[model samples]
Target chain A: GAGVSQSPSNKVTEKGKDVELRCDPISGHTALYWYRQRLGQGLEFLIYFQGNSAPDKSGLPSDRFSAERTGESVSTLTIQRTQQEDSAVYLCASSFGTGGTYEQYFGPGTRLTVT
Target chain B: SQQGEEDPQALSIQEGENATMNCSYKTSINNLQWYRQNSGRGLVHLILIRSNEREKHSGRLRVTLDTSKKSSSLLITASRAADTASYFCATRSISGGSNYKLTFGKGTLLTVNP
Candidate 1:
């Protein structure tokens, strides 16, 4: 009965370094999503994965951002050559992939700070 | 490129008073959801209102949707100090497909003073 879980609750890295954030969705959840939240701003969609289909990459800010989900359980969002502007809280969410379920459980998130 | 917009960026009210937050979106949506975040950490799903349904109630929380106006409102009755947090409205486009991605608004910061 665990909710979504994200590792490395906080990360601080210098600009130009790469960082990987991990998320573990609840059991049986077939849909996973990543989002970024800047200070005092709204949640920005990043990517999504459903079952075995291709992930939705339209929301990735740039090529530096990428994500991969192994099967339907774990996902990792990677930032390559991070920039100072990349600082924000990275949030992960998952939901049941049934026809009309929209309630998503969220992880605590990884607060990434680029200096 | 945000689809939903919430009014009154911030609000302050005394405990036991009623609080209302409004949201407006630009596109047709399959459903609208409300979430609460404390200390900028994880978001807690509060309620979800489908496009067909106009109103819903969960405990002291009341949510109403008007597809004609592309708007929604969340009202909390007899609010407590514990209710202070950042509230956001997320919209799932009618054409969102299987991605299940939600477009969120800027959010409203509510401060309940006890």
Candidate 2:
């Protein structure tokens, strides 16, 4: 079976443009998460979607960042009016929701460069 | 806020030698997990230890958790050159409910020279 997959391995865009990054979680996974990693820094949590529960938006840095998952499969992280500070590698991860282990599988990630 | 903090930002060692990295975190957690990254791309999940677990072993990887001290350690035995990468410790906070959102540390970059 395939591991998590993210589209547009690399994306370059000018400031103020909107960009949508896609993620395809492994089949049967019901939990998905998004995180951002700046150069030489740790990963920062962005948002989480588990089954049909309301997405956890606590980690979203600002209103410009948002994410949506249809059912328990594909997810998209959208950045509205991106800023130069938004430049970083956006990583997606998925795992078994309930009654499963804690390990998570990750996607290759989308390196977004906001110039 | 960052929870887990890995000690010794970087390390270098010869192949076949053992390597050890430690992490200290704040607050109670449901579990601790280790991840490896190559070229700063997708992270590979190495191991996971629940809060109640004291130690675990997976192949050459060993992980120990000390809830009393709020710390954890990752030891890699007989390392290989291919093991050179950044290792990060992450914690799933008890306060995170079902979200299980992990708070990661800055990570320890290990260079294994063949």
True contacts kept of each: 0.65, 0.61
Off by over 4 Å in 2: A98-100, B96-99
Worst 10-residue lDDT window, candidate 2 chain B: B92-101
Q: Which residue pairs show backbone clashes in model 2?
A: none
lDDT string for model 1 (A1-52, tens) is 9999999999999999999999999999998989999999989999989899
Interface RMSD of each: 1.6, 2.0
lDDT of model 1, residue B66: 100
What does chain B score (TM) in every candidate?
0.97, 0.96
* Candidate 2 C-alpha lDDT tens digits along B1-114: 788999879999999999999999999888899999999999999999998999999999999999999999999999999999999999887773643788999999999999
Q: List per-prediction Cα lDDT, in the order shown.
A: 0.93, 0.92
How does each model score on TM-score?
0.97, 0.96
Going through the candidates in order, their DockQ values are 0.69, 0.64
What's each prediction's clash count?
0, 0
